[model samples]
Target: MAAHEMIADDLLAPAASADPHRVLATLREQDPVHWSATHRAWLVTRYDDVAAALGNKALSSDRVRPLLEARKSHDASASDRIRELLSEWMVVTDPPAHTRLRRLAGRAFKQQQISAMGERIERLVDSLLDEFVAGGHTDLIAHVAYPLPATVIAEMLGAPAGDRDRFRHWSDELALVAFGTGGQARPDRHERALRGLEELFDYLRSLVELRRTQPGDDMLSAMMVDDSSGEMLTEDELVGMCALLLFAGHETTTNSIANGVLALLEHPEQLALLRREPETITTAVEELLRFDGPIKVLNRWVVEDFDLRGRSIRSGERVYLVIAAANRDPARFAEPDRPDLSRNPNPHIAFGRGIHACIGAQLARLETRIALAEVVERLPGLRLDDGRPEWKASLASRSLTELTVAHDAAR
Candidate 1:
């Protein structure tokens, strides 16, 4: 299909999911600000455009709140709860509110706290790998990628270890809606997503109450208590934030680990370099993030008229800042398509950019760094299984459905 003929679903196609860099590169070069008739959104592809759009004040991140007013009718009220919770998310709000929420939430991700988690994360990786390597062949995602970050975030939130499985289930359900499944209507998926949202909210509300009564040093407790400015998060806000944290915390990291491993395994030279000089894991992780990161497209609504790359973007229109495309933009990085473990000064916005940049980025970086090091150290002979890897049909994020691999058992 012609680049200009690109529709919203084009990005969600299985082929696109498997190799988005190729598809995005075409759009980036041909039409940086291509309009999608089906999605009713402008897809900003180039590195410059995406970087600019992320920090652009003309765009508003309050996409959820707009839906709240538009879908005010009785028929739409059924999903009002979903929209209400989403609107409360710090990610979907503009200044003042976003500023306040981010400030309060930012406390949960202090540098010291993240730094301290290294040993604990190391222990978790070792423990998980113990059980993981027992099987000669296994799905890396299910064994390591999915559980590592999930358990870490769960423990931080004071969630019971037994409830980790439930979190994964709920997260999967939420992904269907959160990532915009192929831009196709699926009532079943929407219902499951709503159920997952409601269930998560209810579960978090109980946790919030418990933290309020018998607070601890956990993140949820930290969020509930007053900050240096004596600002306290409201109960609903706390619940919403916790839900967002749990989902965002594990989901992206899970994808990063899986994608990072897949990238390394594909590029044996890079993998060998990581094995030879383990210190380079940090840069390796950054390169892995840029090569195939979790974030794909971040949504924004144009609240004011703006001209971008010779295209006019009017108010009340949706804009999709294609991070995947931008990260691979040849104009920004030398050899943008290749994966180089030692690539320095990598400014790829895998976690996003500007005020809405990922709050959990440091923690994610820590988790990924530890997780990749352990995998490379332990699974020395690891290699992909015979069949092709499956990529989730998602537009908002890049994720693997599964990554089955086998390693030499003589370790």
Candidate 2:
């Protein structure tokens, strides 16, 4: 296909391929701000353009409007419920609303609070590894990557331990809604996504009510009380924030762990480097994030007419910032295609940039750091079961459906 055709086609399908770097690189070079007829959004591929777009105040982050419009065409009731649920998400809002919501939830995710859970995370990692270490072979995603963050996030929210699996199910279904399927035009997928959204919202609401009556030493409890400014979150906003934390909390981290492991296994030298210089675990995690971050694309609507790279972006037009592409942009990083654990000054916007950057970034880094460190330390002989692994067909985020690995049983 021609460059423009490829750019205009369904970007998600090609992105799910084993290697999308070439396609992204081509677009970044040919047309950094090419409009996609397939997705009906402008594709911003270059690192500079993506970084700027992420921080551009002229680009509104209120995605709820478009989503509501899309839902309205098919299901009115579902749209109304979604609007109420998403209206309070800091990520989907702009300016004053986003500012207020971010401030209120930011306290609960403070460094001090997240850091205190380090030992707990470490123990959790150890226990998880203990369960599968003797097996010699297991699906890493199921045994470790998925459970670690899911458990931690559930505990942090004071959710019952028994309900972790159900949370995972809700998260998967909601993911289909948040990140469209390859065939979003299909009505069945839309219906399923809406069902998932409703179920997730109902579950979160019940949890919020429980916290209100019997608060505990958890982030949700912390968020319920007044802050230093004597401000409190409304019920809708509270549930929205909790849902955001619940989904965003585990989903991205789960992908990061799985993707990071895959990257390390593919590059044995880098894996060995990590084993030798364990201190580099920090930088290694950063490199892993840069190499293959979970989030692939983020959408922002143009609030006003703006000229980007000599092209005029009119108001109300959607812009899909290809984060995975930008991370591989040669203009920003040296040897952007290669995964170098020691690569410093890595300014990759994997988590995003500006005021709307990921709030749980520190926590994610902490989780990934601990998880990777434990993997290298405990399973020194670990290796991929097969050279080929399947990638989840997701446009918004990159993830592995499963990752099988084996280590020397004696080890």
Q: Specify the highest-TM-score model's number.
A: 1
RMSD in Å for all candidates: 2.5, 2.5
Candidate 2 Cα misplacement greater than 4 A, ranges: 1-10, 14-16, 135-137, 181-187
The CA lDDT at 386 in model 2 is 72
Best by lDDT: 1
Please provide, for model 1 over 253-309, each residue's C-alpha lDDT reduced to its tens digit, 9 standing for 90 to 100: 998999999999999999999999999998989999999998889989999998987
Report model 2's TM-score to 2 decimal places: 0.92
Clash totals for all candidate models: 0, 0
Candidate-wise lDDT, in order: 0.83, 0.82
| Predicted structure 1, TM vs. truth | 0.93
